[model samples]
Target chain A: MAWVWFHRFGSPPHFYRLATRLTPWFAWPAALLCLAGLIGGLVLAPPDYQQGDGFRIIYVHAPAAWLSLMVYVVMATSAAVGLIWRMTVAYAVSASCAVIGASFTALALATGMLWGRPMWGTYWEWDPRLTSELLLLFLYLGYLGLRNSIDDVGRADRASAVLAIVGVVNVPIIHYSVIWWNSLHQAPSVMKFGRPTMPAAMLVPLLLMLAGFTAYFVALLLIRARGELLRRERNAHWTAEAAGATATG
Target chain B: MSEQRVGFAAAAAALIARDLRLALRRSGDTLQPLGFFLVVTALFPLALDPQLSLLRDIAPAALWVGALLSSLLALDLLFREDAQDGTLEQLALCGLPFQGLLLAKTAVHWLLTGLPLVLIAPLAATALGAPYEAMPGILAAVLLGTLALSLIGAVGAGLTMSLKRNGSLLALLVLPLAAPVLIFGARATALAIAGEPLAAPLYLLAAFTVLSATLAPWALAAAVRIGLE
Candidate 1:
């Protein structure tokens, strides 16, 4: 019985309908939480004793960085699922993940640089986290480029799925190795992990923003997945009926 | 399942030997990247001030970058000819395992492209004013580093094999993934130049090389199969 449900959910037309039904559940709460988190973080959160209000960038930066990493894991997992199960919906989900992850990575980098300029006196430092994040951006670009360059959707999905899986394996190695490399060169910086030391006031809003961003990602992913499913499944009878219903109704 | 099938080791050896012979016959495929390595390293001196101290400081990194670009320049050749001639399909259909064949191809690629880079690294370092004391560590690092690069490059080469023109695209796909090799390789040499303990970085490079060597051939084989399909 569960297997039947799973297969139905995996089907493009069924998944498309499910995504449409679910998008609003994710989107509105995400938007509201983001607004509340931004206001709470930017205006209400107490300024840091050491760094002052410049530390406020953490509200945006940390969440974006978290989302960027989380999204890649999601993308790679979905890609692997697609590869193993031969599920087109899974491929659509993975394909939709690339651009969103890239945007979050770019946001993280930009906000990080903004925060860095005031504190470190340089716009960029070859710090481990920053460097690894930049590398993650490159990995995203490579995945997108590979996908776009191939004309056949199925081939693109298979090839890019392989790259994503390979990259997922490397991400941890890249992260830890970069950290090791950084330790030899410089002392630990202000932008390193903050879980243990950060005050609750600061940590709370950051967590809120993180949750909000993740919800936003889910909402956006479903929206994008629907479009991808439509295009990829256009030849199917269900998609044609759905298109006609939307057109006429 | 057939009794007439060639043994895996024998088949792998045959593939390696075939690739090596082809590379040797062409000669240009092997030497062109070596020339590119030398020229790229040579240009750094002309581009920068000829101050020996500055050159020495930058030498490890410069040489590593040169090696990386040169290896990338040669990566496209890894599967291109076989792919063009349908040899890849024939090999895939043969009784030998795809992973073993890919491993052999990667080994031959490293021998032709990466081995020469490792051999000539010292000369590039010397030209760039890397200290004499750093030579052994530089050599060891390059040797391990280039092996890792070739193994990793095989996956990239396989991924891009079906594309008609993929020079820059191959580099783009490979370079970011290859970052650890560059980082550890350059740092190991730098530590050696500074007379610091070389154990950690060299160990890291060795571990990375081993990890890539073990894992990459499977991915390469998969990518090659996808390209063939």
Candidate 2:
């Protein structure tokens, strides 16, 4: 029974319909939550005793960092699924993930640098998290570059899938090694996840922002994957019928 | 099954031997990257302050980076000739295990490109005024790091084998993945230059080498097959 549903979901036309139907469920809530979270975080959350309101960048920075890593995992998992199952929908989802992941990583880095300026007295530190995030951006670019360079879509999918899987395995290793390297150098940096000691007022808005960002990712992923599926399967009978119906409706 | 396994091993050995012979015959292929490594290292003193102390401070990382870039110079050619001549297809069709063949090929590439870099790294370090005490540490780190680099490079080379403009693309694909190696290798050498214990970074480099060796051949084989298809 589950296998039947799995295959049905794996079908491009069926997945396209499902994504189109699901996008709104994610998009509206994401927009509202983001609005609330931003207002709550920027205006209502108490300033830190030591860092003052400069730490407020955490509301955007933390969520973007979290989303960047989350999106890469999604991309890698979907790539692996596509490789193992040969599912076109999975490949489409993975392809959609790369751009979104890259943007979030760039956001994380930019916000991180901005936050670092006043807090650490420098815009850049060779801190572990910052360095690894930069590396993550490179990984995303490499994935996109590999995919774009290949002419055949299927070949590109397979090649990039292999790269993603290999990269997924390395991500943790890279993170840990960078941490280890930073410790060896012992550079004082602004970002550290040493403890969960945030007050409730701050924590709540941060949590809301995280949730909102995740929802935003899902909504964006669905919309992008739908377009990818439609374009890739444009000549298929179901796609043509679906396009015609949408056009007439 | 045992007989087939033996045959596979023999075939893999032959492949390695053939690659080594070819690399030796075209000594330019082996020598060019080493020359490039030497030139890059030599350029550092001329480009930067030629003060011995400053040179010594930067030598470990400079040598390592030079080695890395030079290794990349050879990686694009690792499978290029075979791929162009249809030897890759023949190897794919052969009853031998693709993973073993790939491992053997990677090993040969390391021997040609990586080993010479390891051998000459100390000389490069000496030329840059790096302390002689660090030579052993530099040797150990470069040996393991370059092996890991070759293994990792094989995957990139396989992926880009079918492309015409693969030189920069191969470096782009492989360099980020090779970051940990550069960190550990240069750190280990730097510690040795400082006359400090080098156990931690060396251990990490060893672990990286073992990990890359175990996993990369399969990925390389997969990439090669995709390229062939």
Candidate 3:
């Protein structure tokens, strides 16, 4: 029974149909939660004693930052699964992940910069976390570039998988090295997400935003993965049947 | 058992010797990275203040970056020539462990490019106004750093071997991964120049080098297999 379920999950046609079915389930909740979280965070939560109204940026920035890291781990994990099991669906998921991951990484960096300008009096600093995030963006670009440059789908899948795996392994190493180098240079300290406590007003919305963003990512991933599957399995009979059904209905 | 060990060593030695001979025949290719390194170091002083104090301050970073970029110069060619000429395929199909062959090729890269970089780092360091005391530390750091670079570069080279024009793509794939080496390498050089204790950075570098040495061959071998597929 388990083996049968596994095969169904790995099958591209089945996965494509399932993804299409499930996307709305994620998308509607994502919209509702994000709306509620925004209102709760921006309107209901009291301004910070220190940062005041500016602290609300964390609602967007922290979730973007969280998604950036989370997406890469998901990307790398799917890439590994694709490589190990030779599953087309897993490769599709991995391929769909890069652009989204890169976008959130950019969002995180942009929002962090916006927050930094007034808070740190500069748009940029080589703070360790920021530096590592910048490097993570580069890694995503590298993965995407490698994928696009390779013309063959299977070849590209395996090649980019190798890179994604390598990048994942090095992410922590790069993070620590930046920290160590920053300490050695003894630059002015930048703010960290190491706040000791947050009141319920602030914390609740942030948690909701995080969950909302995750659902949003799933919705987007499922839609993108369905497209990837269609392209990869264009010749398969299910695609033609699915296309015909959609065209007729 | 002893004879099998000897045979394995002999096979690796032969592989290294063959690559060295090929590199020597293309002596211009062998010399290009070193020349590029020297020119890059020279550009810093030309562009920046010629003041010795200022140059000394930026010397560690400048030299480290120079070495890092120069090492990249030779990397794209690491597997391309053999891969194009069918040598890489032949070695893969030869029934001996492909991982060992990958390691040998990486060793050859270090010997031709990395070792010379380590030897000439002092000249580059001195040109940048780094003090005499920093030479030993600079050499040690470059030696470890470049070996790690070669190992890391092999994975990149293997991954990109199938692509016809992979120069910039290869760097893109490798640079972020090489960040730790640059950080630790530059820090050690700074410590050496400042006459401060340099043990921590050096240990960290050594640890990174050892880690890469252990795992890179497996990754390189896997990448080569996928490239060929």
Clashes of each: 0, 0, 0
* Number of the predicted model whose DockQ against the real structure is largest: 3
Per-residue lDDT of model 3, residues B1-229, tens digit only: 3544336577889999999999999999899999998999889999898999899888888888888898899988889888888888988987788899889999999998899998899988988888898888889999999999999999999999889766599889988899999999988998888888898999999999999999899889989988887
TM-score of 3: 0.96
At residue B64, candidate 1 shows an lDDT of 87
lDDT per residue for candidate 2 within B59-129, as digits (tens), equals 87788899889989988888888999999999988877888888889999888889999899989989998
Q: How does chain B of model 3 score on TM-score?
A: 0.95
Against the true two-chain complex, what DockQ does each candidate achieve? 0.74, 0.74, 0.82
Model 3 C-alpha lDDT per residue in residues A1-249, reported as the tens digit of each score? 769988999998889889989999999999999999999999999998888898899999999999999999999999999999999999999999999999999999999999998889999988887899999999998998899889998889998888888888899899989988888677756565636688888888998999999999999999999888888896898997756556554
Look at candidate 3 and give me any clashing residue pairs.
none
Task: Considering the true interface contacts (CA pairs under 8 Å between chains A and B), give the fraction that model 1 also has.
Answer: 0.59
Q: Name the 10 consecutive residues with the lowest summed lDDT in model 2 chain A.
A: A187-196
Q: What is the descending DockQ order?
A: 3, 1, 2
Q: What does candidate 1's lDDT look like per residue over A110-202, in tens digits?
A: 999998999899999988889999999999999988888888998999999999999999999999889888998899876655759887778
Where is model 3 more than 4 Å wrong at Cα? A187-190, A245-249, B1-6
lDDT minimum window of 10 residues, candidate 3 chain B: B1-10
True contacts kept of each: 0.59, 0.57, 0.84
Candidate 1 lDDT: 0.89
Whole-model alpha-carbon lDDT for candidate 3: 0.90
Off by over 4 Å in 1: A192-195, A244-249, B1-3
